[model samples]
Target: MVGTQHAARILVASNRGPVSYALGDDGELTSRRGGGGLVSGLSAIGPDAEAVWVCAALSDGDREAVRRGVGEDGVRMIAVERPVFEAAYNGIANSVLWFVHHLLYQTPLEPVFDEDFRGQWASYQAYNAAFADALAQEADRGAAVVVQDYHLSLVPAMLRERRPDLRIGHFTHTPWAPPDYFRLLPDDVAEEVLGGILGADRAGFLTRRWADAFAACCQTLLGATVTTTPAGPEVTWRGRTTRLGVHGLGADGDFLRERAHRPDVAERITALRAETGAGRKLIVRVDRTELSKNIVRGLLAYRQLLTDRPEWRERVVHVAFAYPSRQDLPLYRDYTAEVARLAAAINEEYGTPGWDPVLLKVDDDFARSLAAYRLADVALVNPIRDGMNLVAKEVPVVSDHGVALVLSREAGAHAELGDDAISVNPYDIRATAAALHTALTLPDADRAARTKRLADASTALPPSRWFLEQLRELQG
Candidate 1:
């Protein structure tokens, strides 16, 4: 039974928390916390609704912090065992769901329902159960619970089974694998995944397309009642309604503008300017070194662009910050090494003593990345696939000289930013290279006009409104 407590306690759970920690030389864990859509969205969860973030801890320091509870009010961090996080993050979330969406795996070469896979599935289940148990403990009676991403899909159902009064919402930040692709999972697995999410009062995607895909899964696999309406659609199982909504995420321009003015940012920009010398059109990209990011392909395109068009040789520089991710996995390690190799090759092939064509930084430094955005004349956001590339939205809002964006059609942000961007197919090296060339050479007036449009599109659904819209619709 839904009750008035929906306005009170709210819990946000995901693989990554708003903060991360590291053990210092003094044997004390130091924590770094900051902003993003999730941070801002949960911030708007309001005074009445307490926000407790239960996230998996991957590092020794993270475990220490989790044990010590090093966080601000309303932010509760829980660190699962290292093995659980490894299998859950690498084996299940990235291996299974990521491949399902990007269609990255060759089905013929894929292993299905094998012993190794089943073991990983167990880890995945246990990890999600951890979040569900935490939510059930923290959420007061009738509290509203919002679970984030495919990683924690099972939590909605498990939590609801424990706390029926709780109003739960689940949002998938990746494309829903089509029913055909999803069928690759064992039949029981498929049914359970859909049913788990359906336990929520509301389920959300970034677009109508993703929502429709999810509805199709329910109708075909679960034998559920699926209804289409003007607002969107609904998935019903056992007389309970699970409304599907689209809350397109956005950038906090006002906050970013203020952050950009800090003295450290000014010094970094000055340093970058001095380092780059004169008349270099900067093409910037910031991405985690995940397989789906297609960093190797992006590098191929950059090289092809230089080889095919000699004129752009010394005119441009690509500032790539591929922050390290999932070093626990062999696949991730191999991918990172490949990226480093390509960066070195590109620099060697196209460099003088004074300049390198590609400036690749593996370390995750936000201020430096933001500084890149401010200096960039062309921001290359060619994600092989993304739920929503916040960089697409953030660049336009923070860019000092109104940077032109060369975007990939597969990105979730493409639906919103395509009209204003120089869109490209991430798979096609020549095409992406040409698109980059076009973006780099775009005129000032055109860049400004496109930047204005992109900024407007970026601001369409601010975090507060996005959060509120989901809350209001959940009640209906």
Candidate 2:
């Protein structure tokens, strides 16, 4: 959607790029394009639009490619030393920023910020500086640079210092912790984060609640002046005013439909269809095994449903795909093991020779996930807190037979889909179980109507338009 002349001036900086290269047995590097909102947004800009994707080298293959100067034509990758990258990525970005934003750390004993954390914090800054330098070097004069997610939160401020003529925008794809919880971060680090983000002309969040949370952090922590206006929330610090904007990134309906119809997806659908017996309803949940996903609670709620509503037993199947994530972190590994353990216990308790109560798959398969979306009768997305649970939006848009959504009130998707979904408190297993029962029993007519409305709202702003809208705001 970018204008022809302006397209060349647009640059996207993020932790990962649209494409990655892998070396094959024959010694040829193969390029593979990624999927998801970020990739879709970049692709929507049109192939001829002279855009560049700046990203960090994630794998040894990527680093080798960087060394060989063999990258996807449009991507510029920054390859830091392995130790530095690991500490910056796992130690700070994932362990600290991700946990803080999601409020996952327990206040009683965790997040010990000692000498070790300070060392990692320095690496985090160096890692961010690498990105800032890459983006600044590649971007054209007066370019519009959009930095994404918590990984590169410092890039906006760093890039601003080097390229003042460029229009900079930073978007957070995670929930912003409230002021009190955010104060858990060391005072200096918290202030630095606020100052880094405020360096941009515009700071964007997935929901207004999160945007307000960021504004409150600036006011309380930095003692910065905050003012609300029709334009947007403005934070003034040391004479510079940065606007805060909310943009809920929506599902790409056309892309999902097209991909859902692929041959591999059809094959997966046939395999899943065999698992789903006749006369049984399907309950589908797809998620990465992230701590904030509350996967264990969702499993507990499903178990509760079977216990409380025994009539639905053997009449319904819970198809959950918990793709592995952050396995390097001990906490995530233990959490994943717990998820497997719970699913096993549930199967042992209620599964029959003819019908298994739960079918849990931990492998990553996009085609299988899409197949589940198409056939889901009920879609469960009960994250404790989420920026925007795209699975909540994706299921409604792709459901062949209408799906009843059991959504979490804390999810950003609830802002748009709450009216249609059976909402529940994420912490209440009983309430979630009740909502699941309500979703499964809803009349087909009402379910269809609600699904239609949800599909409309979820697809309200496709990736192309979402990117363009934010670009317009930053440019303004």
Candidate 3:
């Protein structure tokens, strides 16, 4: 156990850690480092920062590592019971909360908060309690703790109750549903979720729009008093105030530019160019097949483009990378299949002897994605709702020849990138199709200029700085 002897002055809590372990055939665990805002932020703070990352044991190897007390320095992995973790993580977080936030639920036949849901809710509570207990044990007096995403929404309050001396912050990486949409959760559950987040000293979002939506929910449901400040908004409930701040996470431009030029990525670029054919313009979209990504609608819009504009036939190819996400949930698995089905349909309808209208890859390949970014003439990023679509930011940074961005207004990235992008309504397939056409036809100089501006906006708040700023704000 990482006890008081290793108490941390700074702490980060999330469902996933910066490193994961895989058990080899020989029974040795191989550790793989992860990359994201949190990992980059922690690394930027340096090794001697006295920071500890409290995360769950997400895999069998992770559980085994917990048993063996084998982990990277400044990391504490809690081995929650498998059933409990699943019920909370998949059953509630991914299945319930994700659907609610993203507005992915079908109104006629879903979200029945029955006995099964109650059981899952209990597990969710236990899951959060485990994290809260672990964080309370590891935090030093007045330590600053940042909890990540919806998976740990309840942790801030739970931890606050346990260690009032600690300064805790909660950042939601998903969109905050509008008050009406948010109330879809059972009355008690809605209040509980809002109250849990309000428990933080600071609650952070990816955009001002989402932050406002959160405040509206608190005001409408919890009767929290909200006030505007120079920094941002503050929601006070039960005589405790939680300040809300917006931090739009940006692309690691230096990393993407350097990594995109690697020999491996170059090889992929060549291969993709060859597969796409000579003199053919490329439209690229890279995304996890999360339901909210609106991959199907994007494909439908592309099909519309082919139907409406025959002149683009054999002249343009859409390179789509729809990697699987949350396959443990049946809904996600079905969405992935639907994506595949539609991609195949587009090819069948528009493909020719020399031209394949859409080149679809379901497997995840970072090198390939970077290659696509470099080769894209148009970058399609149409999400139903996103906290911030990093793909929208990254393509511009990595594009060798600047790519025109067809962005969705619903994405959090739209707040920053909309002015320079050909913004479209995600649900409007015809409008998105028109936007893609406009992007494809944009003059070279115009596209290049827009891309440069987007690249700048996208890197305005890099991952390390984003994390540090939040940490600083929490400490203050």
Candidate 4:
């Protein structure tokens, strides 16, 4: 039975929380805070507000914590049955929603929606229902509930049915698929996902383009009526109107600056500075080897730049940090291998006795990434699609020498920083190569000026303020 407590509380539901725990050999539980915009934003909300972070247990440590019954910092950890969790998280959310929105899958040979997919869809629902039940159990009467990302799309509707008094908001940290692509989901699932989101009092996207795409999907698929308002886009369906909003998540400048100056970062900077050599311009890109990240394409573009412009042969070095991501998935593993192979080919094609043209590292090192960001003369972030690529924002904020950004038009960051960045079509190898050249050659004064504006835009809604703003809007 759901009881309505009169006190208002802030409830944040996401696939992962601000902190994760580790179990040591001594059976002691150690905790560390996680990074990202959400964690920053939640930390910014200040200490006065009563809040609870609801997250899923993704690892053995997390499962242990869940079984023991609470996250380190009072977060509620839910452990759905393993098979169900994997099918929902890996099957539907990552495979279906992520691919459809990013336009990653090869439509002809993939996306076979068979009995296996149907079973996964059922698991996805069960996963979401588990979250909804947990959230409903925790939320106070008339509490402000903010759900995060595609992993929990169905939670809004499920929770709304249980707690109508709660002010619900859903924020997508990824691009919403256009109606045609979104309809690729079985008709019933498509309707339910849209209907689930529409159950919220407010649904927020990283950009107006994404918000509009979502509204279009609702209009086309569910025949929901959408109207423009000063507040934002409003969708009315089945006598309930859900307000849509464009809320871009930005970098935490204060935190980054402090972290960038740490001892580890200082050591990394000295090491990278030597690797870059003297008098050579450094073009850097730090990305996990996610298919949507377009790491291989970015490497190819760099190769094309070397091929087309011979003068830059020994003068520029492309320092690429291609960290591994989702290695459990065959597609991701293959993509990472391809990134490595292409990078090696570039080195073989362009390496001189003194200069290795492409220095590619697959290790995950935050200090090294920041060191590269500071040294970057040109920062390349060419993703096929992104909710908001924070690297695009973080580089400008930390660059010691003014860094010119070569951004992907497909990234959500483009809406905020594209005017200053040399924008390129993610699919156009030649165009991306050209943009990199332009970024590398921009006047120092121009680069500095753009860096300032870009930094301002990137930090406009720092984590704490971004979270608080949503809470205000939902309550208002």
- Output the number of the TM-score-best candidate: 3
Candidate 2 local accuracy as lDDT?
Answer: 0.90
Better of 3 and 4 by TM-score: 3
Residue range 7-110, candidate 4, lDDT tens digits: 32888899987777788899777777888766766667776666778888888778877677645544778889999999999999999989989988798898
Q: Give the per-residue lDDT of model 3 (tens digit) for 98-183.
A: 99999988989987999999999999999999999999999889999999999998998899999999999999999999999999
Where does candidate 1 stray beyond 4 Å? 1-8, 19-32, 65-73, 79-81
Ranking by TM-score: 3, 4, 2, 1
TM-score of 2: 0.96
Task: Identify the runs in model 3 with alpha carbons over 4 angstroms from their true place.
Answer: 3-6
Residue 439, model 4: lDDT of 88
Clash tally for model 3:
0
Q: What C-alpha lDDT, on a 0 to 100 scale, does residue 450 get in candidate 2?
A: 99
Prediction 4 TM-score vs. true = 0.97
Give, for candidate 3, the lowest lDDT window spanning 10 residues.
1-10
Rate residue 58 of model 1 by lDDT: 62
Candidate 2 per-residue lDDT over residues 1-476, each given as its tens digit: 11122234778888887767787887777777787766777677778767778888887678778888776656788898888889999999999999999989987899999999999999999999998887778777888889999998899999999888889999999999999999999999998899999989999999999999999999999999999999989999978889999899999999899999999999998899798787689999999999999999999999999999999989999999999999999999999999999999999999999989999999999999999999999999999999998999999998998999999999999999999999999999999999999999999999999999999999998777788888889887
Top-down lDDT ranking:
3, 2, 4, 1
- After best superposition, candidate 3 residue 192: deviation in angstroms? 1.3
Better TM-score candidate (1, 3) = 3
